[model samples]
Target: MDPRQLARSSVPRSLPEARHLRQDDRFLLVTSIMPKNPAAVAHGPMLIGVTINVLLMGVIVMQAYEYFTSYKRRDDRYLKSLVVFVFCANILNTGFAVADVYLALINHFGDVQYLTVSTWLFVTDPVIVGTVACSVQMFFAWRVQVLTGRWYLGLLTASLALGQLICAMLMAWKCHQYPAWADFVKFTDLIIAWMTTTILVDVTITIILVWYLRRHKTGLEGTDQVVDRLIRLTVQTGMLTSVWALLDLVLFLTQPTDASHLIFQIPMVKMYTNSLMSSLNSRPKPKVFSEVTDNIHSIAKFVNHRTTMQDGTMQFASSLHPEAAAHLERHELGEFQKKTIEAASSGCKGDAKTGWDNAARAI
Candidate 1:
């Protein structure tokens, strides 16, 4: 009469009993339909995902610091916009990690009593991926907008992002409708990645064209120099990101689940490498760079002062003018010349045939 006794007394399905076995299969299929169990959360896949998010967050923090310290007014906009895109993208990924953790904690299953058990995956995964994809596209659009001040290209980015978002939503919808929509997940992930990569590239090229047009129109040497450098930097970074993205897409799309892990490893390594490289690039070595620059400036100022005095470019027309002697005396410089003067006074500096003057001779 006890419930436990009743459950124990129930007939077990034999392998030959198709209907009973079906029922058994449906019951035991919990593992198949399940998203993740708490124990599963401790596995390698979850660890890898967590590591990725933490690493990405580290890079974001480093870049955010770089952005704050970057003093150049022009570079601020592009750099900050890109940083924002990266920041948001990383956040979206972190959100996915959290969702996965929750799913794992709950031991996600399609046929669970609670409808939310599987529906959460349908709603969350696509949204995270979609936001990141569209945000990256917009980041490129922002770059193009600044370079050309053009609206049309930005509009194109917006349109493409909107379309991707819609597809992402549909991907979720289909999954929600049919619990076995594995293809929906694959399709949605691949499409967004492909579109994101394509649009970013296209928008970048459009930006380059705009820069070329502007540079050619105006004979602006100074502006041209900076833009040329920007083009090179962007291309270098973009190429690296594209390479990683392509590898990820190929692995995710073409490989079977078990084999996919190996293929995906390449991209994961690339991602970590990129984070390191990007951090190095963005980090300001202020002491080294600034000290070197200062030394160069000092040397340049020394050379110019000497040249101007020697050539009378910084001289007096008449001895009656006090400022001329004062200016000349300024060019003469300081006591650090002791060694050079001593060497010259000792007749050990500069060969006469070389036509170079010693500090002793000048003084």
Candidate 2:
């Protein structure tokens, strides 16, 4: 064969073959550069949702335990009704959350669009969670007011709580109106305001409680122990909730496409309710300290004679031990009778008789 003939044949006579190879190269480049839905940041929220539901279940169990053990015995008709309302709201919240998971993942597994599309299940979440949050915060505001005898604290906290609740409701309404998960980022300002207000309210409550408890500290050893306990409890509960809210806000702002915010948002109601129940139930039971020491009588008298003043529509008490005063104001006088009894009881449990006697003498 001639050299020219070989060159001409080798030049590739088919134009379509050259175009197909070029297209294949382009396809490979695009596929390599662009992220696939499954491999990219898709499952972050789905996995978070599952974990959140598990935690929510635990919260409900704890709520039930607290209610049966303490609230049932401690609350009157009105208070018990409030407990019932909160519990019922939690049930609804959990139901809707599970439904959201089902719709977004289990029911429409392969459908990527469903994940970013807001449905009725997602729309109702803010309403349910916001209502629960508002009720709990307002309750805390009233309690803090009673504890500190400061009407302004309650008013301020309640105002923030109301603001957050309103923002949440408005956010939810926007979700319903737009009906797209992607559209939610458009209301980022409202979401930030909602989270910021809740965080402020929580931190403010913590500061007020801790400040009041510290201010009222009697130099007495037993009284100091009780005050320390109150301060620790307030800090732990208040900080945990506020920190979770902060984390949610951070994730929402940084990873708007990921539903990682749900992780912190889901169990917040449980935090509030559990904090309330713990505050109520942790007041030493009378029988638990009945045999401990004679200091109980003096503490009992102090709690019984807690200072009271009428302020507008509310009547509250003020005392060196504000926790005791809060119990008294709520008509939980039996629980109040042993406010420092646990401290006294612990003090009396020393191995040496002299230690018990010294503890008794100190009290």
Indicate which candidate wins on lDDT: 2
Return the TM-score for each candidate structure.
Answer: 0.47, 0.73
Q: List runs of model 2 lying over 4 Å from the truth.
A: 1-43, 289-295, 298-363
Q: Per-residue lDDT of 1-363 in model 1, one digit per residue for the tens?
A: 332232233434542353344444544443444454323323234446556656666766665566556523424455456556656655665566556545644554332233223345324555555555555555555545443446786677667667766765665566566543233354546455544544455445445544544453222343334334444555555556555555555654564332233223222322423432353344324444443233223332333333323332232122111111111211222332443334333432333212113332232
Q: Report model 2's TM-score to 2 decimal places.
A: 0.73
* lDDT (Cα, tens digit) per residue for candidate 2, span 1-363: 332332333334543453344444544443454334431233456456546656766766675676567546646777677677877776777777776676656677755456546678767777876887788788778877766667899999999889889988998898888876557778889889988988998898889878877888655556567678778888987888789889989988998765567777766666666666666556554454433343334443354354332442112234435335434323454444343343334433342233334333332
Q: Weakest 10 consecutive residues, lDDT, candidate 2?
A: 307-316
lDDT for residue 244 in candidate 2, whole number 0-100: 81
Q: Best by TM-score, which number?
A: 2
> In order, what lDDT does every prediction score?
0.43, 0.64
